[model samples]
Target: MRIDKYLWCIRYYKTRSIATKACKEGKIRVNGDSVKPSRDVYPTDKITVRKNQVNYELIVLDTPKSRLGAKLVDIYRKDVTPQETLQKLDLLKYSKEYYRKRGMGRPTKKDRRDIDDWFDTPESPENKDDSEE
Candidate 1:
């Protein structure tokens, strides 16, 4: 199976197009080498997927006939991603909490405009040029 299709089948990506795009962008690698979208995949191949600041490592177990569900994904690939990497994702989540609370959704238009205005405003007296000596 193609690497992109395998990734999609194993549920590494939401869609085959996204998987193919990631391969085109060189975000997917096999056995320590970057692979193209059409690259062939086989059992026991070491696959690495870089997404959202994480490098996920997986070993191909078998090729699925089609996209698998979340529970059935383990039958196709064995995830070997380090525990530290997952901890980092947790830390990143905490860091982002300082900026926005949970369930807040995206910033509203007025809020974005206010933030832009705040940054665009003049610094202060030092930034002003009112010297009349």
Candidate 2:
């Protein structure tokens, strides 16, 4: 299967466009070198991806005939070395914690006040010299 298609089928990306973009940006590597979207992928290949802040590494076990659900994900690939997997998990955990602590809710009055305070603070002044002279 093509690298991009395999990635899409495995649910690494939400859409093929995103997968192609990742390939173009060198976010995907195969056999320790960056690859294009059209590159061929086969079982036992080592694929690495840098999505968000985490680095995920997987070894292809089998090519899925179709897109799979979460329950079927294990049949398609296997997690790589323990240390790398732990690092990836840590990064994901940190990202989730950061988002949760920041509160993914609509801005409250207090939140707006905090934003305004930062903008109005003298030490972190906004550039007010917009007038072209």
Candidate 3:
């Protein structure tokens, strides 16, 4: 099967187009060399996919007829990614928590305006409020 199609069938990518785009960007390698989306994939081929700031290594065991469920993905590929790489992914998740706490959602318009005001400038120090005068 084509590399992109094979990745999609194995659930490596949510859509075939995403797999193809990754292949075109040279983020997918087969057998230690970069491959195009149309490259043929076979049993025992080693695939290295660079995604989410990690290099995920897997060996093709078999090609599926169609996209597989998340639970059945292991049947078509054997993930050989190093433990350290997965650890790094976990670390990345932890680092992002410092920037935004959970359930905060995105900054609201008022929050943005407040931030902008804080950074823009204070009225000249000499421009005191009537109360101060």
Location of the lowest summed lDDT over 10 successive residues in candidate 2: 124-133
Candidate 3 segments whose C-alpha is farther than 4 A from its true place = 102-133
lDDT of 1: 0.91
lDDT of 1 by residue, 37-120 (tens): 999999999999999899999999989998888899998889999999989999888898888774487987888898799889
The TM-score that candidate 1 achieves is 0.76
What overall lDDT goes with each candidate model?
0.91, 0.86, 0.93
Please, what are the lDDT tens digits per residue for candidate 3 over residues 1-133? 9999999998889999999999999999999999999999999999999999999999999999988889999989999999999999999999999778854879868888987988998677567675497
TM-scores across all candidates?
Answer: 0.76, 0.66, 0.76
Task: Name every residue pair that clashes in candidate 2.
Answer: none
For candidate 2, report its TM-score.
0.66
Question: Which ten contiguous residues of candidate 1 have the minimum total lDDT?
Answer: 124-133
Candidate 2 stretches with Cα past 4 Å from truth are 84-133
